[model samples]
Target: MKIDAAVCSSARLARDRRFDGRFFTAVKTTGIFCRPICPARPPLERNVTYFATAAEAANAGFRPCLRCRPDSAPGSPAWGLVSTTVQRALKLMRGEREPQSVERLAERLGVSSRYLRRLFAEHLGVSPLAVWQTERALFAFRLLRDTHLPIADIAYESGFNSLRRFNGVFKQIYQRTPSEVRREGHSSRVDVRAATPVRLYLDYRPPLDWQPLLAFLGARALTGVEQVEGEVYSRSFAVDTGDLVRYRGVMRVYNDAERNRLVVEIFGQEGGTGLYLLNQRLRRLFDLDTDIEEIQAILKEDTLLSSQLRENPGLRLPGAWDPFEYALRAILGQQISVAAASTIAGRLVTRYGESFVDDSGTEWFLFPQAEQLAEADFSDLGVTRTRAKTLREFVAATLDGRVNFAEQSLEDWCTQVTSLPGIGDWTAQYIAMRGLSMPDAFPASDLGILQALGSEGEKAKPKEALARAEQWRPWRAYGAILLWQSLKSGEQK
Candidate 1:
C-alpha cells in the first residue's frame, strides 16, 4: 500500500482519473489533501506528500480540499485489493454502527487489537478509530455541502451523539464550525435549493461498459422488489438501524457517463445511517469500487479473454443488493435458465415480500426476510422439491446465523453454503462472485463458459475450463463477466 512518489506525482500532474481514489496528494504549505484528479494546479514536488487514504491524510493534519471533494472520489481500491483482515475490518467499519473500540472490532475480525492496529497502520497509516472518525466527519461534510438536510439531522445521521460532539469534530478537523463552513460555501457558490429527491453521485473508473452491465441486471430484475427501466436500476431496501427499527426506502441508480460516475437518487427520507447503508449497498450493487484497469491487465493475458477484453473495456461483475436475496435468486437459478429464474423469483417476491409505497407512489416490496422465507411454504411456487428444499435450508441457515455473510472470506462462505443440499460448486462459486464480491470466484462449470471456450460441436470439460482459467487469477470474476457479455453477442456458439 506504499505510494510511489514519482508515479503518484506523474498521475497528479496529469490528473489521471485511473488513480483517482487509489491515492491522495497532500500539499504541505496549503494544509489540504486533494484527490489525484483534483483540478488545482500541481504543487512543487518538495511540498507534496502522498497518502493511501483520506483518513491517513487527515491524521497527518491535512483538511480535505473543498473543490475536489475527496469523500466522493470513490472508495479506496486498497479495500478490495488488500489483506482479508483489512477487507473484513473495512466492511465492518462501513456498517451503520461500527465497533467503537479496537478491541471489539478486533474481536469481530478474530484478530488481536494490537495486530489489527498494525494492519491499519501498515496499510492505511492510521488507526481504526481515526479511519472511522474521518469517515463520519467526511460524510457529515458532504451532507452539509450537497444537501439541505437540517444540521441536527445531519449530526445524527453522521453518527454524532449530540450537536456538541458534531460541532466539536467538525471544527477540530476542518478548522471551522459547520454553520460557518456552510455559510462560506453558500456565499461562494450559487443559490442552492432544498434537499428534494436527495441526489448523489458515486464515482467509478473509466471505460465502464454500461450497456452490458445494465442488460445483465435488467434481464434478471425481480418484480415488486426491483426494476431496471432502460438505463436506471431501482429497488426497495429495508435496513435495521438498531433497536429493531426498520428504515425502508427506494433507491434509483443510473450511469452518468459524462462524469464517469453513477447517479444515485433516494426517493425517501431516511437519516444518516440509512444514507450510509444505502451507499454501501449501491457500491456493492454496481461494483463501483473495482479497479478495472488492473483486472483487465491481468485478464487480457488469457487468449479467450483477450479478445473479449479488447471488445469490451471497463466490463465489471454486477453485484447483488443483498447477499441473502442474491443467494435465493441463485438457488432458484439452479439448473434453470436465467429467464425462468427471474419469473420464479418475481412470483416468490410478490407472494412473500412486504408491500409498501415510496414518496413517488411507486408500490414496492421489501425482499422476503430470512425468517419469513425459512418458514414459508414454497411448494406452491412451482419450484421442484429439491430446489424448494435448498432454498428453505438456505433461509434457515441465514435466520439461525449458520449461513453468515458478515466478515467471512469468500472461500469460507462458499464452503459453508455448498455444504447445504442442492447447492454445489457452481452455485457456491456464483454466490461468492456476486454475493461476497470475490473477484476471483469463477464458476468454471457454468455451461455458458463451457460453450464459450469450447470448439465447434463440443463443450469444454469443467477441468479444462478451470485449467484454462488459471491465467485469469484474481480477476476471473471479471473474466466471467466478459464471457457472459459475449453470449449476448452470439459469440458463445
Candidate 2:
C-alpha cells in the first residue's frame, strides 16, 4: 500500500473518483472507512488510517458506510499488477470448481507456497484465501438481493457446501440474518429486472464503439445458439453441471460513468449454476472491462498497427463462444479468413452441441465438453489427423486435470496446450487469447498479421512482426484484433 501522503491528502480534499480503489480512508473517530470518492464528508488527517481492500478495512473493525457500498466498487485493476496467478485464482473461486488452497495454488504458481503467500500479503494486504472467501460471499449476496429463490437453493447456488454454513457466514459478516437481506427487497419487488426476461446489464469501459462490435458478432452469428442484433447479444448453453441455462441479455454502460463495469441483468433460475458459468465466459468474451486507451497509445508508435488503431481503437478480438469450438475453428481456419473461421465454428457447434428451449428462443448446446470430444474420432469429421490429435489432446487434458481451463495462469495454460503434438506458437497463442481470456496474449506469427505489416506503409518482415508488436505493450492482444480487421478491410478495397 504505497501511500503517498500528498496524493492521499489531495484525494481526500477533492474526493476524486480516480483514487477510489487505490486505498480506503478509515476514519478513526467515526468508526467508518470510505472510498476516496465517497460522497460523505472527509475526515481529519490525524484520525485516518489506510487499507487496500474492503476486507482488510473490515478486518480492522470499521463498519461499512451505508451511503457508499464499498462492495459495489469496481474491482481493483490488479490485472496490470502482480503475477497472473492471483487474478486467475479469483476466477476459479467464482466457479467454486478449483479447490481453494494457498499451498496448492502456490504449487501451480511455480513459486514456493511461502513466496506466493508473501506476494498476496504484500500486494493485496490480505491472504490468498481471504480474497476467495469475500468473492463467494459477495456473489451469494448479489444472488440473494436480486433473486427470489428458496434459502436452501440460494445457499447451494452461491457455491456453499451446506445451507447451515451459508447462514452462519452471511450472518457473521453482514451482522444480520439472511432473511433480513431478503426482507429488505420484499417491500415492492425483487430486483427481478431480467432473469426470466433474459435481459442483463453487461458492464464495460467507456469509448466503446458498439456498432462495429455488434456487426462483428452479427455477421458471425451461429444458428440456434447465438444472436446479435443492435446492442443485444444473446446466447444459450448447458453448463458443466448439465443444467440448461439461456441468457438473452442487453448490454448497458454502468451507472458510474467513469467505471468500466458492465451491469449484466441475468434472467435464469435463481439457483442455476449455469448463469454463473456464463458470466465467467461473457466477461472474457465481450472484454468490455479492458483498458484499450492504454493499448492504442502504445500501438500509435508502430507503423503496422498505428493506422489500424486510428480506425478501430476499441476493436476487440472476438473470443470463443466455446473454447474447444474456438480451438477447432482456429486450427481448421489456419490459413482462412475470420469469416471462414467463424463458419467452421458454427458447423462444429451445430453438429456436436445439444439443444434446449427458453423464452429467448431455442438455445443450442454449449460446445461439447472434453468428455464428449475425447471419444470423438476426427477421421470422418473433415479435419486432418494432426488437427484431430490436437483437438483430442485438449479434450483429454481437460478430463484428466492436465488442462483445467478454469484455474491456471496464462503462461501455464499456453504451456499445457502447446505441449500437445501439432500445437505450435500460433495455435497456442490463439487458444490463450480466446480460450483462457488472456488479454495481453498476442498471436503475432499469423500469416495475416505478417502480410498486413509486410505490405503496409513501411514494409516489415514476417519475423520482425513480433518485435513490431512489442510496442503495443499490455494491449498486444487488442492490436492483433485491429490488425486482423485492417487486413480484411484492405483486401476488400
Candidate 3:
C-alpha cells in the first residue's frame, strides 16, 4: 500500500483530497506534518517525509501543522483485510470498557494480547492501546476545538480518568495543552451557530447515494424518536450515562474538498451534549468509515452477477442505532414488510422501554436490553405463542452470552443468528452485516432483493436466482441496498 515518493509529492502539490488521510507529509524544515490536502504550499521534496499514519509521523519528532489541523482529517476507513479481530476489538472496547489491561481485552477477542497487538501494528502501525487511546483522545481533542465545555467535564466525557492524565496525553499527542488548542481555533465560520442545534462536521468518501438512502430511512423512521428531512436525519439518544439528550440536527452530505472525506454537520444541541455519540452513530449509519474502494475491487471480477455491478455502486445500507434493539427488530421482521416490522418495533419499545424527554422536545425510550427483555412475557402482545417463545429464547441467549456476536466471526454470527428459532437466513445475514459489522455477510435468499436484481427472467427458478448472484461474492450486501431502494421508490415500504 506504499505510495511512490514522487507521487506523494505531486499529490501534496495539487492538494488532492483523494490522498488526504491516506498518508501524512512531514516538512523537515518546519518539523511539522499535515494531510496531503493541506492548503499551504508544498514543501521541497528532499525535505519531506511521508508516513502512513498520524502516530507514525508524530512519533518521528514531527509536530502537527497548525494550518491544516491534521486532527480534523477523517478517520481511516476500516475494511477489506480480514479485520474481524479489529471489529471484535472495537466492540469490546466500546461496551463495558474497563480501565483494565489489554491482556484481558485480548482474551475477550479470543486472541492473545500479543497477537492482538500485532494485528494493530500490522494494519494501523500502532499498538492496540494506542488505537484505543487515539480514538478517545482525538475525539476529545475535536470536542475541545469545537465546544466550550470545562476541562474537568471534558475529561470525564472523553473517557479519561483525570484532568492531569488528559492534559498530559493532550500535550504529548498534539504538542500543546487543550486550552491552548482551543484558544488558537479560528472561529470565522460564517453561520457558526453552536447553540440548541450543535453543528459538528463529519467527513466520508464520495459517490454516496444520498437521496435513495434518506428515502428509505425516512419511511421507516419511528414516530417519537426520529425524524428525517431530505438527506438529513435526526433523533434522540439515551446516553449510556442514562441522561436524555436531544439534538436538532441536519446533515449535508458532500465530498470534503480538503480531506477527501464525506463531511457531515450535526447542529442543534446547547452544549454539544451527544456529539461524540453522534459521531459514532453517524459513522455506523452512513457507513462513512468503510473502505468502499477495497470492497468494490473484491466483487468486481466475479463472473456470476457482473451486470448488477453498475447498479448504484456507492450504496451503503445503514446500520443500527443500538445493537440489542436492532437484534430484536430483526427477530420481529420475520415474514413481514419493513413498514409492518417497524411498527411492531415502535410499539414494543413504547410499551416496555424507558421514556424520557430532552430540552429539544424529543422523546425516546431507552431500548430494553437483553436482561430486561429476557424477563418479559410477550404472550398477550398479539404475536403468536411461537413469536413470543422466539423472543424469549433470543433475549436469554443475548443476556447469557450464549449467542454473543461480539466474539463470533462473520460466518459464526450468520450461522448463530439463523440457529435461533425465529431468525432465518435473510434476517440473520442482515444482522450480521449491519449489527455484527460483517462486510462479507449477504442474504442471497432475500425475495425482494432477488426480484429487484431482475431475477424473474420469466422462467428462472429459485435455484437459478441463487446461481445468478454467484458473481457478487463477498459484497453482495452492497447490491442488496440498491434493491432495497428500488422497492422503496415503488412505495413498497
Highest TM-score model number: 1
Query: How many angstroms is residue 268 displaced in model 2 relative to the true structure, after the best TM-score fit?
Result: 4.7
Worst 10 residues of 2 by lDDT: 247-256
| TM match of model 3 to true structure | 0.85
Error of 1 at 438 (Å): 1.0
Instruction: Give a tens-digit lDDT track for model 3, residues 296-327.
Output: 67656654323444665666667777777777
User: Residue by residue across 236-303, what tens digits does model 2's lDDT show?
Assistant: 55555433433232222222234545555444443454544565566567765465656666878877
For every candidate, C-alpha RMSD to the true structure in Å? 2.3, 4.4, 4.1
Q: Which stretches of candidate 3 lie over 4 Å from their true place?
A: 1-7, 78-83, 94-100, 186-197, 241-277, 298-313, 360-362, 454-470, 486-493
Instruction: Please give the lDDT score for candidate 2.
Output: 0.63
Report residue 176 deviation for candidate 1 (angstroms).
1.5
Better-scoring candidate (TM-score), 1 or 2: 1
Q: Report lDDT per candidate.
A: 0.82, 0.63, 0.66
lDDT of 1: 0.82
